[model samples]
Target: MNTKKQTGIHTGLPKLLLIALSLLTFTVIMTACANTKSAFPDSEGKIKITATIGMITDVVKQVGGDHVSVVGLMKAGVDPHLYKASQGDISKLDHADIIFYNGLHLEGKMVEILEQMAKKKPVAAVSANIDHSLLRAGDEKMGTEYDPHIWFDVRNWMKATEAIRDVLIEHDPDHAEDYKNNAEAYLKQLEQLHQEITEKIASIPESSRVLVTAHDAFGYFGDAYGIKVMGLQGISTASEAGTKDVTSLRDFLVESKVKAVFIESSVPRKAIDAVIQGAKEKGHELKIGGELFSDAMGEDGTTEGTYIGMVRHNVDTIVHALK
Candidate 1:
């Protein structure tokens, strides 16, 4: 496979794992059901919602609460832009009442599949509620018709939360009030998060307020915090940081005396190290600030495993590094 093809192919591993887990869970439940006919009363069926990635799945669970069971199609550390659904995923989708995805092209190769599924069932683009003006122009980057990483900004993510609530209400109208209340609560939390991040970023010295990363995943974040951000690649995971992008960033870092550059949890670090090495060649050394949760959240069973925790950890890391 070609370089881009290889990247795309590997991205499906997470989805495959999720699909497998869902199938396993389903099988276990079915076996239990077969053994006991009257073990539990089955009068009402719960709504099943599936998301393309963990972050979206997290929000859906928060909003849907006990009325819905949410599944994240992508596993931790997987890139949603390159994920492909497996046969197991098809089975999971076949049974889902409603599905949610981070649209605006974040689900790369899976976009078309999701679209086809939408025609047959209820599948809403959670990111559709995001204002177009707020979206970053991904025109300059390859395969990025428009940047789809709005979730980077807590405020922008409120839009996603609202969209999720709307979709849930549409499908499960009996629990409309519940979804609204949950969405409101989540939105309040997100607003508080936005304020906290602004304060934390503001604590950094003005001269040192630069966010450099493996991919252009922080445009929304940079816009929110007044920090100058640069990414080696475009919004699309398919775009690699070529020699030219690295050379330019290195020159800028050395000239500006940038203290630290960050690597992302999901993206490879080779490109970031190359930037640091390039700066070193120019007689300046830049430290690795910290790993940021860019396209994916941290591993399970960690504080950074949740959306709130991930944002807090990133803020803490950046403030400590740049301040």
Candidate 2:
């Protein structure tokens, strides 16, 4: 799940390794030869972009059209909470014309490296302009940072899409017209998708609107579509689900008669399985609703590969299970 962070859990690299990575980033910044931004307007080739997650990569590709070539560091089912960039990913960041990522501590372990690179290049977080009031506040255990699952809220993602379009226009002014046209078309599609999701969710019986999943990744989704969401784990998979947590959730399902529980593609299924067993012991026959794309989108070339596709899949899956 490339859209979250955690504390007191798996930091991708040990403390010593992170220090070395910081030093290496500084050295790369100092020695970097190309200033992609200065040369961007005149460059005949596609703008080379390195994005941290597939969602951002898709945005860049869509807005930049034929003008940009983008690569995402995190792939399908790769949890960004635990992702550590390799030497190759560092090289990609160093060589890119511009870099984009989800901020709000989503890519926790890569923070230092990204900051080091931003000193020399155009590195932007797509959620840079989201109002603080719009974000879901985190609890003390997760610190005071806002939740990073902004994409689950279609409105926030539309803002992010516009941000990507504007950045591409600013950096590659020659393609401003194309970028503008592409963004307008894409934003319209997103508007339609948002409406579709809203109406579809409204069809589910109000009493069956609870969505149980492996983690709290769908908090934004739940808020946006009027669903009551419960997770076995906290916001980040870095924390483990204890017996007490499972028992409590199980008791809720039994009491509420919740129809189904979902498994996340990026999270482990063991916790979900335990919850199901607990529910069964209490006489609730909860079905596994469907595997939802929470932290990571589906694989490339599939319907779930695109951001729109992923959202549609989640909503449709939820509607089927709950209805």
Candidate 3:
């Protein structure tokens, strides 16, 4: 036997030792790669940002521009009030350099998870800086907390935009100028949007400004745009609309002779349909004005997906139906 150890790859270490050394080297490389990828500007040279909802994601995308990669956990027509964080969402949150959410209990189910994550990273509520006075008091059924739908009013959204801009600047100062410029441009666009919606809403008669919907997500919109909003469900969709609630809203619709009630994209249509049936029984003809984007925006690529487009679509829908 040519057992002269056939001058092969010779290592003094045992097989087990060789294996351990291989694993160690692999782990070190992996750790180095992970550390490099986790840097503020990721491997793609963009900050990794995660947002709880599409609205916040839109704002971040508008402001972060090319310097950030955003992941929105909530899709169109997903209700934030009832949304729970998934394992994938947790992973995204863990990997994100920063996270943005509407806050003020909008994301009811995920609040605890988000709170816990806040201790470890920059988790910010885009609506955090809004003056408390501007917020509508949440209905008692919805815990009587501050309403989290601050994005309804353009002014409030401006505040949210500012908060987002500030956070982006704080976390990634290298792109501070980009964020500032983008925010300023977006603010101007929002100002224009506000004026446009105001003028369009002005076309609707004051008496017809009643905006009945599936839920009370539009309280801020109503308050800002001079409409009377009523919903079978409370501010949070997590609250069910009882029979009594349906009956009461039906009576209100009949009494006020409100011509149209709206359905929300995120809320189930059953409740609104019940109200419609109840109204029909009372001899009031109520139409489903249109589906409004509440607690969510429209599809991603459509114009309605954008904040400006969503607001405009809502204003136009309200005016077209009620006016």
Best by TM-score: 3
Question: Order of all candidates by lDDT, from best down to worst?
Answer: 3, 2, 1
Quote each prediction's TM-score.
0.85, 0.86, 0.89
Off by over 4 Å in 3: 1-43
Q: How close is candidate 2 to the true structure, as a TM-score?
A: 0.86
Off-target runs (Cα >4 Å) in candidate 1 are 1-44
- The lDDT for every candidate, in the order shown, is 0.83, 0.87, 0.87
Please write out the lDDT profile of model 3 over residues 1-323, one tens digit for every residue: 34546433243447768899999999988975675455333437788898988889999999999989888899999999889888778877877889899878888888888889899999999988899988888866666578888988999999999999999999988879999999999999999998887788888888888999998888888888788888788888888889999998899899989999999899999988999998899888899999899889999999989888998888889899999
Per-residue lDDT tens digits of candidate 1, residues 167-278? 8888889999999999999999999999999988998989999999988898989998889999998888787778999999999998899999999888889999999888
Clashing pairs in 2: 1-79, 1-295
Clashing pairs in 3: none
Tens digit of lDDT per residue, candidate 2, span 1-323? Answer: 44445542356558868899999998877655344433233445788889998888887878888888788889999998778999878878887879999987888889999999999989988997788899997644755378888899999999999889888889999989999999999999899999999999999999999999998888898999899988888887777899999989999999998879999999999989998898898878989999999989999999899999999999999999899
Q: How far does residue 16 in candidate 2 sit from its true spot (Å)?
A: 40
Error of 3 at 190 (Å): 0.5
How far is 312's C-alpha from truth in model 2 (Å)? 0.7
Question: In order, what is each prediction's RMSD in angstroms?
Answer: 13.6, 14.0, 4.1
